[model samples]
Target: TQPIIVTTTTAPQQGGSGSGQQGGNGSGSGQQGGAQDLKEVLNSKVSKWGDANGDGGVDMGDVVLIMQSLANPNKYSLKDAGAFNADVSEAGGGITANDALTIQKYLLGSVTKLPESYAENIKTVTAPATTTRATTTTAKPTTTTKATTKAPSQASGQKFSVKNGQNQFKGDSDGYSYEIWLDQTGGSGSMTLGNGGTFDTEWSAQVSKGNFLARRGMDFDRTKKATDVGKITLDYAADYSASSQGNSRLCVYGWMTDPLVEYYIIEDWVNWCPQPQGGSKTVTIDGAQYEIFTLDHYGPTILDNQSRNFKQYFSVRKSKRTSGSITVSDHFKAWADAGWNIGNLTEVALNVEGWESSGKANVSKLTIDVSGGGQGGNTQQGGNTQQGGNTQQGGAQVQAGKKLCAISFDDGASAQSTSDPGYRIINALAENNMTATFFNVGSWIKTEQQIKYEYQKGMEVANHTQTHPHLGQLGSGQVRSEWEQCNSKLKSIIGAEPSHLMRLPYLESNGTVQSALYDVPLISCAIDTKDWNNASTNDIVNTIKQAAQNGSLEGAIVLCHENYATTAAAMEQVLPWLAQNGYQNVNISDMAKAHGKTLAGGQVHTRA
Candidate 1:
């Protein structure tokens, strides 16, 4: 570097003394530098060293100020500083021109393109050292625990239950758990937990109608043949009497062709008239004794036509069964008549469209007088001729032994009247907490919400044929279609077929509709009130008042449509009037049982 500077100071053309000359201290170099004017110009254009604000010159504290701003950006105002002075702003934070120069210098071997590469020489050197140190470390282990749980098994049996689990459904473990009691023995028995009581969970003591059931997991197999079961020795005399007049008790005993959940019925006659009063039969299964005490399935539904809720009560005095014969002994026979088959309904009731498979009946404090319509008595607009009454010129049929009664209402569920007087009548009924049988049209039950609302409100949706036609009048195919469609629709909308009762469109029929009821019960009315013809309120009330008195018409099944607002209004007068009288309301289901009933044409899984 020094040699080059010396050469520039002593150029011979400048006429100044050369560096090698005696006066070459270079003070006289100014004379020779006069020709090189470019040198001065070049010095003037160089970048300022410390002018951090980029005004092209270095200041006293540029570097220090840049460092201070980098440490605390808030201390320096971006607007007052240029890129050179603002470290964050100029370097884009920490980037700078020097960094780029360093990278470029590394890529070029000598930082300035190998120093023009005229001539270059490189040297190598090395250094080494040896050292050692050691230490030990320990690690911790992990721990974990796991838990296991077991699920309980369900009990088996075909059973019936109630929501409350108290009255009307005591001594039965219906809801506290899931179970179905099948092939149940009719005789008395008891169960006591002994030793550890072979069950997975704690056992709940159980009893039913004085009979006991062993808990699940017990060694006594689930499918026990009760054909040889002992008798349910009941003290009949304690609660039963023979010579009782109007308020006699009747014990019902029957063996199911198949396992059953409950005895169901269709016609109001079956429900109202315990007409099938008294008789007994025995079946010998494997020489074991099985007895069925059935009343005549005829009477009120047959020749008499008098609809009466007649139930005969019997107490079990003794029962004994051998492997060869299961014998049942009871005395529910009270009335003068007795028959095992209630025979075909037509043979029994003379004018019955046909036989109604099963039915109901009840004996209570207040006697009831049912019109063709259940409690739906009072009004229907027939014509100007019969404006004051709900009666037609039909023969007396239904007979009620009890003094109290309630009528069932139909047509209230039709789309046309769901909210009119039909609706108001229901509201009125609700005001009194009254209940009635409402045979619904299949078409109306199109949604789940509708069915749920009706059920929650305590209104029963029974089958009124797919359409409102006299079922007996349709062809066999049409009849089958009617029941099938209604059943399917009801199942979809209501979750199950209430399948309790069915009414013929006109108490009119042929053999076709009859056969379709293998799983549905038949509900034949006790009387023909012909409200569809528009019987008047006064006529309805008066006819019902007489029905309560007349023998054949005592338990008459009343029929009424909801097309007119008059029916709902009329019920107000009739129902309160019945309550004021000796009449009491009875569920249609209970009424049908008196007739030995069940769903006729089909069966369904009653359990989930």
Candidate 2:
């Protein structure tokens, strides 16, 4: 069977008296004529950036139009001319928040002109040049390079399969099931669901009630909160065809309970009922972009379930895609940010809804990789755990005799630290392909970009209190604020929260401090370089060299700081020497893993 092809284009209106152009909403007596006029204006080649209302002007009205379109895409679409004018940023192709900010800056006199590379609304024509003797010359054999195309894999039955006949439902592999409910009284067509977990099935159906559905996917425990789920991913490919009077859609259905709400990620839709609400926010997940739409008070489930006040968030692709993977967790985050109190995730299903349509969809691949907190699961636990049956005050005990050493830097994200000495230390570690743990002081993090660069380059960013105070001397509340504030700042800077590891300032901690930090493990140095005492380069190198010679470097946590020029100079020699002398440099978590230990709060890990 041939694949279904979908096209989107605005048709010209018939019998329009005049171009009754209207802005904001695409509603007017001559809506199609307005579109036609906009296309003509674009063809005339005289529009500038930020002219979203298509009135040939760059002003606040244009900004308002763009904002309104973004807030409600269904009511107002950029379509063509508006899209071309509103896209003024370096992003080049999309009308996004960045473009809106650029327009605002221009209005505020922050810029003189828009981006030079912005596409102009001009249609250039090249007249064919007249050639005299070229036609007489023998035309050499033209070389055509045929584009290579990969054939889709044939569907195979492992645990799930589908076919045409009366509606049926069955269970499949990996705790998944397939269900097809069709109202045959309205229409007729062949429906077959096939493929292992790697692909989707081809489905065709006709119905008047708009109730034909073919579902294939798994259901998770709905009682677990969204925070507990780590990652959910779906990769699929779909094709649809209709008889001009038919309608169909391919969507991923996730049913959540407690409040009984449904979440749908629609891959494609054609002439479906209950038109989507306006306003769309774009998000990139798993390298694919999706336009998210939210609808509230949509009323009872599509399956005619009990009527309950429910909300729905649909993440639809900007364009129909044949194959792409989406990280479902990110969408959940976006919904939550929009004030949707998402309860525990219950069911994750990928299916198609059709009305008088015929076609097929292949899942190709689908995966739900859930990690972190869940129902009855502890969210404060770190990723690494201790080996053996030994239980320490924090969590587990580290075994001895592991040839691993953790190199840590402390108190040094300030401008002074990131200057010559800091770059020197960072360069030395990068050149040596060594990984180090940085316990950063929150207030000292002046160069956030540089710190994020280090994180991207494989260095671990842990917590060192905000003010580097003596935690044992501070009150319990102050201690908690110090750590929590530092963590919050780190997350804002690097988009990650270091909930697993932290080191107290001046290595100061007591029962109160430990009690306050019961979630993050306390990391103390097994070998203190004493570089903060203004130790000379030679002195610092000798301190570590002596430790290595004494065999105390095994499974050792070496503490140093980038704040000192002497420390940076010493590392140039110490790091290479450690590598040559059989000591493997790693982060704290890795060192703990090597020694069969799990890191948790309340316990200090010291080399034995």
Q: What is each predicted model's overall lDDT from 0 to 1?
A: 0.30, 0.54
Query: How many angstroms is residue 439 displaced in model 1 relative to the true structure, after the best TM-score fit?
Result: 0.9
lDDT of 2 by residue, 1-608 (tens): 01111111222211111112121111123223344454453334325666664433454445544554454342233423465577666323345556666676776678668642333332211111111100000001110111011122332432222222223222233324344454534433223434434434444454455346666655443324554456665555555444445777777776664455678877777776344667767777556787777778654442222254777777877676555666677888877776667765645567777766665555555544444443211211332221211111122122233255776888857444446676677777767656667788898887887677666655667788898887878887888899889888877887754534677677655556765664456766656787877778998899889978977677677778877789889989888887787665666664544433334334444431
* TM-score of candidate 2 to 2 decimals: 0.37
lDDT of 1 at 55: 25
Off by over 4 Å in 2: 1-402, 416-419
List TM-score per model, in order: 0.35, 0.37
For candidate 2, the 10 contiguous residues with the lowest summed lDDT are 133-142
Candidate 1's C-alpha runs over 4 A off are: 1-406, 415-419, 444-451, 473-477, 549-554, 593-608
> In candidate 2, how many Å is residue 129 off?
99
* Candidate topping lDDT: 2
Instruction: Summarize candidate 1's per-residue lDDT along 1-608 as a digit string, tens digits.
Output: 00000001111110111111101111111232232342232122223322332322222123322332332222221111232122211121222333223222322333432111110111100000000000000000000110001122221122221111110110111111111111121221112111111111111112232211122110000011112111212111111111111121122222222121111111112112233244554433323333334332312211111333333222221232111111122121211123321211000000010011211111111111111211111111211111111121211112244232336666435434356655665555555544455666676544455445555555555666777676646777887777667767766765644544665554443334543443344454544345556667777667666766653232334666554555666777777766556554433443322221112222110000
